[model samples]
Target: MFKISRRKSVNLSIAVALSFIAVVAVIAVLIPFAWENTPYFSKLVNDVVINESQQLGRCVFFVWLYICFAIVEACCVMVFVLLIRVRKGLVFSEISVDCLRYISWLCMLLSLFLFVGEIFHPLMFVMAMAVVFLGLCLRVTKNVIELATSIKQEHDFTI
Candidate 1:
């Protein structure tokens, strides 16, 4: 028989959540690739055209969508790596810090992308602000974690 500690159970739960996020991100990326052939996506495109000016070509719109999805996929993969590190009890390690930094940068990139997208669609400006806020939060969290890791190492060496 195998027994799992409370901490292990928590880690497992987190891992499951991260896995779900990764799957969703992947689906998001795949959907755009399949968008041209999917009737639902085609209808959605038609609706957008009906509401907005048809100045944006479909190719350009899809290219931008793919770029955004790629960024999201990269961020999800980084988060999954961070989750693995957490499961191994390496939350304060350098690799974890790097992962956090990468995720933060990805968020920043997304914010910028959305900001540019806002030129064509006003709603994207709101999304850009939200993404920038999230990125700043992650950056702050990464800094705090790095400081804590350094302090812990100093304490260990002193003892």
Candidate 2:
């Protein structure tokens, strides 16, 4: 009969969330370094692309890729905020639903960008599919949160 407290569970989740944010931030910063090692990734930002137009395209591609990373960073922050709401016993609230919706939208937007990036790198297509899946999951979760929030509101009003 051993059960961990809610606060402890939330704390552990927050720690994991923070770790994800840190790891993603580090990887985003080091993305340029990783590009050189992969064949598909090396097309942009390398001497292999000798034309001026190609250099510009590579720069833009990398910038967009960095922006995708930033989107992921934002999602992690949203998850952290949502976990805090759970810790405060506000999981079935409008704010939590809103946070989840924002995350879902961000995931969708990131996936759109990644799909376009498939032209430059094949990995982009794979990442796009994964992000779309994540987005769909988030959307479903947001819908559940919205329903719970409405039911909670109704119960509060009845009381």
Candidate 3:
């Protein structure tokens, strides 16, 4: 019989979530391009643009969607790496700090992207605010981990 610890289960859950996000991000990136020639997509472009430059609007929309998905995919990869480090008991290591720092930056970038998107759709402001909050929380988590690593090294040297 095999036993799974609570911590391991939590880590596994996080890994699964991150994987799911990555999969969804890939799908999102693909769907826009795949449906670019579809009638529904053309109608959507016409509706959104309400101008004669529907083709240009469609192109811009695809590019923006791809950029968003790329950022999300990058964030998912960073989180997966961080979760792997946690599973390996390397939470206090420099690699973990780097992962956290990068994730924080990604969150900030996502927030900014959403903020700009809000100019076209006001509802995106809520998502932008949420990403900003998540970024701040990740930044604090990174600082705390850095501080703990420093304290651990100091204690080890003293002993």
Off by over 4 Å in 2: 1-6, 32-54
Model 2, residue 97: C-alpha shift (Å): 0.3
- Show how many residue pairs clash in every candidate, following the order shown: 0, 0, 0
TM-score per candidate: 0.74, 0.82, 0.82
User: lDDT score, residue 95, model 3?
Assistant: 88
**Weakest 10 consecutive residues, lDDT, candidate 1?**
49-58
Task: Please give me the total number of clashing residue pairs in predicted model 3.
Answer: 0
What is the per-residue lDDT of model 2 for residues 1-159, given as tens digits with 9 covering 90 to 100?
A: 888988998999999999999999998888778776776666444443433576577687778878888898999999999999998898998899999999999999999999977766667899899999999999999998899889989999999
**What digit string (tens of lDDT, one per residue) describes model 1 on residues 1-159?**
899985787588677767777787778668757876787646544555433544344555666777888898788788878887777789988899999999999999999999877644778999999999999999999999999889888998999
> Candidate 2, overall lDDT?
0.86
Candidate 3: 10-residue stretch with minimal lDDT: 43-52
Candidate 3 residues 6-109, lDDT tens each? Answer: 68786776879687886877789578666856776566566664446977767766776677788888888888888777777888888899999999999999
Count clashing pairs, candidate 2. 0
- Candidate number of the best lDDT: 2
lDDT of each: 0.80, 0.86, 0.81
